[model samples]
Target: MIRVLIADDQELIRQSLSFVLDAQADITMVGTASNGREAIELVRKEKPDVVLMDIRMPEVDGVECTRLIKAAHPQIKVIILTTFDDDEYVFGALRYGASGYLLKGVSVSELANAVREVVRGGSIIMPGVASKALEMFARMARGSMQIAVDTQQTASLQENEWRVIREVGCGKSNKEIAAALCLSEGTVRNYLSSVLSKLDLRDRTQLAIWAVQTGVTADPYGDRT
Candidate 1:
């Protein structure tokens, strides 16, 4: 079963999420926390497969909590759930290695599916949130946001690896990329893993941001793009 922890300041929300998730046989509600501090403690103790995190909390916010969790236990996947989809928080969550961003208003089934997706080593964003996230990224590129990685380091990627990076920037899932490139999902996963290793990226979100920052997807259907 997919182990999950819910962290929300509102008791009602926590209870509601638990009620919805408990109905799924594939998922187990391992624990719940009322604040980021409690969530961090529970995370260290329980080591759940996925964490449904809230952005606002009393002791600590979700962004910092995510950073701590990933730094201490990179294996644990975090999905930021919040009512607000502010650009700073979205970018902050991704930068801190959150597996996904989701609105609390998303259906219970969608939330469960998102948790599964994150557990399976896939990144997800609520439908509308993703478009806005991409738009924020575009603005960052156009503005003065510094590219986080060393360009010289990424200069070693082969043509095919660059292609993989571009595809990731477009937010195509592994299965979609496989079908589009006429490759097996396993092959696509392998290629992406290799790309991440070579480029020293933490996750797909970083890879996608880097691709856009480098303008790798600017040219449609181009080899490097």
Candidate 2:
């Protein structure tokens, strides 16, 4: 079963999510928290596989909590489920290793699917949010953001790893990258993990950002105006 924890300042949202998630036979509701601090504490205690987090909270916002959770327990998956999809929060969540970013308006099915995706080491983002994030990524890649790794490390990537990074830069999913590269989904995932470690990055989001910045995909999207 996929163990999940719900963290939101609103009690109704917490309870409602708990109800919806508990109904899923393949998922179990492990715990709930009212704020980021509580969320971190509950994560330590329950050790849930997935956490549904709200961006805004009383003590320790979701982004900071995500950073802390990933730092302390890299095994845990965090999916941001906030009413707002502000750019700063989106970037912060990704930079800090959030597994996914989702709006609170999502249907129960979408929510459940997102949680499952994160547990599978895949990520999901609302299309609108993703597009905006991509636009931001494009700007950052244009030289506004400084890549943390050394130039030599980037030159050491294998050809396959380069392909995977390019696909990631183009916002392709693991399954899509697998199909495009004519490789198995598991292989794509392994390549992604290897790329992250080799680049000394935290997650695919960072890798995607770096790939674009480093010109891995001169035109990440082909034949687009």
Candidate 3:
């Protein structure tokens, strides 16, 4: 079973999410917290497989909590589920190793699916948030953000791997990448894992940032420099 912890300041949200998610046979609600400090404490004790975090919690906030949780327990996955779609919160949470960033507006089913996806080593970003993220990355790319990549390592990437990276950089999910490349979702997952290892990236969010910074997403089919 996929164990989950909910960290939100609102008691209603915490209870409601717990009630719905616990009903899933594949999921179990391990605990709930009203603030970042409590979230951190619960995480240390419960050690859930996934954490559903809110960004605006008092004490530590979601971004810091994610960082602390990942630092102490790298195997645990944290997904930011907040009402805020602000760029700072989105980028900060992802940069600190959040596996996913989802708005609270998502259906319970979608949220549940996100938890499962992250547990499977996948990243999730809400569609609207994804577009904004890509745009922000593009803007940063145009400015002073420079990501140095190893030429030899990059040269070792296979053509199919390059295709997968490009799609990921474009903010496409495994399902979307599979459809775009006419490959199975499992194949896409493999490619993603390969790319992550090859590039020494922690997760898809970093890959997307690197892809944009390196101009990989600028020309999908163009020559690799």
Candidate 4:
């Protein structure tokens, strides 16, 4: 079963979400918290597989909570569930290791699916948030992408490497990439490692961001922002 912890300041949201999530046979409600501080405490003790985080909480916020939780336990996945879709909140939460962002009012079925997908290392962004996120990314890259390109180096990628990078741009996990490319997961990891080395990137997150910025994915609409 997928163990989940709900962290929302609103008691009604907390109870309602818990009721829905717990009803899923494949999931278990590990615990619930009313604030970021309490969420951190529950996380340390319960060690749930996934955390449903709220962006606006008293004393501490979801972004900081995600950072702290991921720092201490990177294996635990966090999906921010909030009413606010502000660019800063979304960007900051993901920058600090949030696996996904789901705007409030999303269907419980989709939210459950998101929790399952994230546990498998797949990142999911709500469609509306995704559009705004694209705009945010394009805007942020406009002035800085050229500098990154210059600093990275004169690097060339193989066809297979390009395939992996493109999938990374789409936020596909290694398992998904392997399935898509008809390659073994081990091979996918090696390809990603090679891409990171050639590009002087630290991890897949950087690779994904860079791929989008450099248009390596060859996405015609990436510049729409």
Candidate 5:
């Protein structure tokens, strides 16, 4: 089961989220917190697989909480939950190691799926948030492309690994890649692990950004495969 900790200041929001998430047989709500500090304490104790973080809260905010949580426990995935689409909060959370972001209005199914996706090392942005994220990415790309490219790391990827990187860059899930390549999901996951190791990437999101920055996404996955 996927263990989760819900961190939201509003009692109602916390309870509602817990109710929906707990109903999933594959998920368990291990704890809840009304603030970032409390959330941090709960996390250190529970060691949940995922954290549903609220952006705004009393005392420490979600951005700082995310930074702290990731610094100490890098294995726990954080998915920011917020009613606001504040670009500052979104960028800050991502920079600090949030794996996904979802608006409070998102469907229960979508929220649950986001948690699962992040746990699997895949990132998700709510449908409406995607366009904004893309815009932010485009703005960041201006500076990112100008930065020195690490060719040595680029040279380490094999042809099949490059294909896996491209699929991930296209936002295809592991199962989708497995189906398309006639490989098992475990095999696809192994390919991803190898790709990350060879490329010296932090995670799939970093890999996707590097792939786009390095202009590796221009080629089709089939050709690369």
Candidate 6:
């Protein structure tokens, strides 16, 4: 079973999510917290497989709590389930290793699947938020954003890998990338894993960030070197 913790300042949200998620046979609610501090504390005690976090909680905010949680327990996955879609919150949580960023508007089923997805080492982003993130990255790329990794590593990437990166930068999921590239989902996942290892990135979120920041998404197929 995928153990989950719900962290939200509102009692209703915390209890509601816990009730719905706990009903899933594959998921169990390990605990709930009303603030970031309590969330962090419960995380240490529960060591849940996934955390459904709210962004605007008092005391520590979800973004910082995610950082602390990941820093202390990298094995635990965090999904920022918030009403806020602001760029600051989106990128902040992602940069700190949040496995998913979903708006509270999502259905209970979508949220439940997201929890399972993250537990399987996949990243999830709401469609609207994904577009915003891509646009923000593109804007940043036009100014001063650049990939900090070694050029040789990037140049060593295969053409198919670049295709996968481009699709990811466009905010496509593995299933979408597979269909676009005419490959199976497993192949897309393999490419993602390969790219992550090649670039020394932590996850697909960082890979997408790197793709946009490096302008890979802007160009068509061509020699990157």
Candidate lDDT scores, in order, read 0.80, 0.82, 0.85, 0.77, 0.79, 0.83
Q: Which pairs clash in the backbone of model 2?
A: none
Query: Local error of candidate 6 at 135, Å?
Result: 2.8
TM-score of each: 0.85, 0.84, 0.93, 0.75, 0.82, 0.91
RMSD of 3: 1.8
How does candidate 1 fare on TM-score? 0.85
Rank list by lDDT: 3, 6, 2, 1, 5, 4
Higher-scoring candidate on lDDT, 1 or 5: 1
Writing each residue's lDDT as its tens digit, candidate 3 over 1-225 gives 999999999999999999999999999999999999999999999999999999989999988999999999989999988665556786678777888788886888898899999999998877777787687567656665545568777977888888888888888889998999999999999988998898887788778878888777877562364
**Model 6: lowest-lDDT 10 consecutive positions:** 138-147
lDDT of 1 by residue, 51-108 (tens): 9988887898888999999999999999988665456776777777898788878887
Off by over 4 Å in 5: 143-149, 170-188, 218-225
lDDT of predicted model 2:
0.82
CA deviation > 4 Å runs, candidate 4: 139-161, 167-205, 219-225
What's the count of clashing pairs in each model shown?
0, 0, 0, 0, 0, 0
Ranking by TM-score: 3, 6, 1, 2, 5, 4
lDDT measured at residue 133 in model 3 versus the true structure, 0 to 100: 69
- The superposed Cα distance between candidate 4 and the true structure at residue 191, in angstroms, equals 8.2
Name the TM-score of candidate 3.
0.93
* Angstrom error at residue 205, model 4: 4.2
Error of 6 at 25 (Å): 1.6
Which stretches in model 3 have alpha-carbon errors above 4 Å?
139-147, 222-225
The CA lDDT at 167 in model 5 is 69
Please give, for residues 103-146, the per-residue lDDT of candidate 4 as tens digits: 88789898898888777556667666655656545554564433
Prediction RMSDs, each to the true structure: 2.6, 3.6, 1.8, 5.2, 3.1, 2.1
Task: Give the per-residue Cα lDDT of candidate 6 at 148.
Answer: 72
